[model samples]
Target: MCFSASASFVGSAGIALVGVATLMQVRTPRTLLFAAIPILFALHQLLEGIVWLGMDGRLTPPWPQLAGQLYVFYAQGLLPVVMPMAIWLLLPSGERRRIVPFLLLGASLSAYNLWFLATLPTDIGQCGHSITYHNPRTREMLVAIVYVIATCGALLASRRRWLVIMGLANLAGLTVVALFRTWAFTSVWCFYAALISIMVYWHFRRERMARHVEEAPQDHHFPAGNGP
Candidate 1:
């Protein structure tokens, strides 16, 4: 189904809310940073939608255009930087060896942004009749591929099986969206907005699972006169 500007905004708002709620599941060192990634991503799409509605096209003019461009660049690039840092902090000291692959993956994706900026024309007319400067669908497909690789690398290294499953599922979904090219809307922005909304829902489900575990009392007995 096609999404109007208001609907897009509402979807982003839900995503942002879910991201924020996910952060509250625990006060881990990585929680805020990791959760913020999705929120920023959701907001990035929301702002792009607002700009599209304002400009009546994808390649809007002036500040909003630049702002959206910058946001996308950072979201695509910096998220990798931050995700590895979060995973590093969460990993056990003995498992520090696992961090190498994640670092390499994140760095490689971050480098793609630099290469894209250097090789691609940032000129206004390069893309037209749409809300993005480049062919957004093409760009998004590439970004999804990079994320698939990076997250897969992380999942493989992660001791947690759930992370592997979730990472694989995310990779599969993004790959489908990229390859099939049959989205609910013609607008690439709308497709991303919808895709990210599904991701936000998945994050919420994870948060609920975390809460359930936290609420459940532990039955293990500690040594007498000693406590955790």
Candidate 2:
């Protein structure tokens, strides 16, 4: 009925869908790790949206007698940064064995987020917009910087041109977020990441197709023994 509720519901649903899609496609550690990023971020945004919708306005500082702020700090501030790091670190070696665990873990975290939102008051400030002492959003932004660094380093190690491009773009976007505190370009980075993911996926698929093509029997019309 409220804007915050609607946004939160939509955001949460979208993230859940992403998690489901990722579950269907995750057949490798890299995909699992990569998919986890969007999945977690989507859920984080959804939860924040939920808080916004439920409250119907900005939450006062030290809400519900300070426990509210603490809750917000952990849920909105910490989990988004933590979950992806966990998935990236603990991801299985191969896709087949990982599907169940990865899906279960990711889904569980998302579900927890959903449940947490459902139970809590919607009155919380956006992470970095706080005017109080217990602000955690700033720390979360710094955490995001760490993510950009690690992701860029990984891209360089892979030596994939598309990855390098995407990695650099993402780093640039995060830098913009850090410095200007605006995210007009961050939306562009999201699209860029999606494109890069598709390109890398298709690139590998094409390589596999080429291998198949090469391995196929050639129809060379050689005169049986004369060729030998």
Candidate 3:
């Protein structure tokens, strides 16, 4: 397998594990939304693997082009909006207000990017050890800034320590990719984000266990039919 394929496979496996753990404890709409992130990311990684095979000549003509476009669709068209929206949903109502702007920005950007993707051509190629996805519409600095804010800002604004850590890790990864490997930003950063998603599973599982512990004593003190 190629570097891209290898990386994508590893990422997909990690996210799949997180997805299982997430499913085990999801108890609310917000938790469901949060749980979906790993599955979405796993799909994203799998699509990238297809793109890799396409680029490597392991797949036929139009297939590579199609795979490339699909990869771009997720990286540029869906992720900005999905990331912030998921984070916003996971936050408390009071804290959610602070993330509203990010969610709105992400939605607007995603809409525009999806339109751009539909009308424009996307080019994908291998660069050094990563893949570079080219779409002229997404090259502007303003878009870059807003993309960061929409994706990273929501995570950073979270009251959860784990989410904050994930946000900081992603921010640092994005900064490094932007500065040193701008061409491979999408590929590299997605991998980084997928790795950090493990923290999300940890956060959810820990919270669920803590809640169970808290409820155990209460359940013991107050029998099913007893009331003060």
Q: Candidate 3 versus the native: TM-score?
A: 0.89
Decide which is better by TM-score, 1 or 2.
Answer: 1
The C-alpha local distance difference test score for the whole of candidate 2 amounts to 0.44
Per-candidate RMSD, Å? 6.7, 9.3, 4.4
Give the winner by lDDT. Answer: 3
**Model 3 lDDT per residue over 104-124, tens place:** 999999998899889988778
**Better candidate by TM-score, 1 or 3:** 3
Model 1 alpha-carbon drift over 4 Å, by segment: 1-4, 57-60, 118-120, 123-147, 182-228
Model 3, residue 42: displacement in angstroms?
Answer: 1.1
lDDT of 2 by residue, 1-228 (tens): 113445445755665565555555545555555555545555544444434433444554333335434434444334443434433443344523433443344444445544544565434333333212122233345444444544444444344465456556656655654576443222223333433444344444554567789999999896668553
Model 1, position 134, has a per-residue lDDT of 53
Regions more than 4 Å wrong, model 2: 1-19, 29-31, 57-147, 182-228
Task: Note the Cα lDDT for every prediction shown.
Answer: 0.56, 0.44, 0.81
Question: Roughly what TM-score does model 2 have, to 2 decimal places?
Answer: 0.47
TM-scores of the models, in the order given: 0.67, 0.47, 0.89
lDDT of 3: 0.81
Models ranked on lDDT: 3, 1, 2
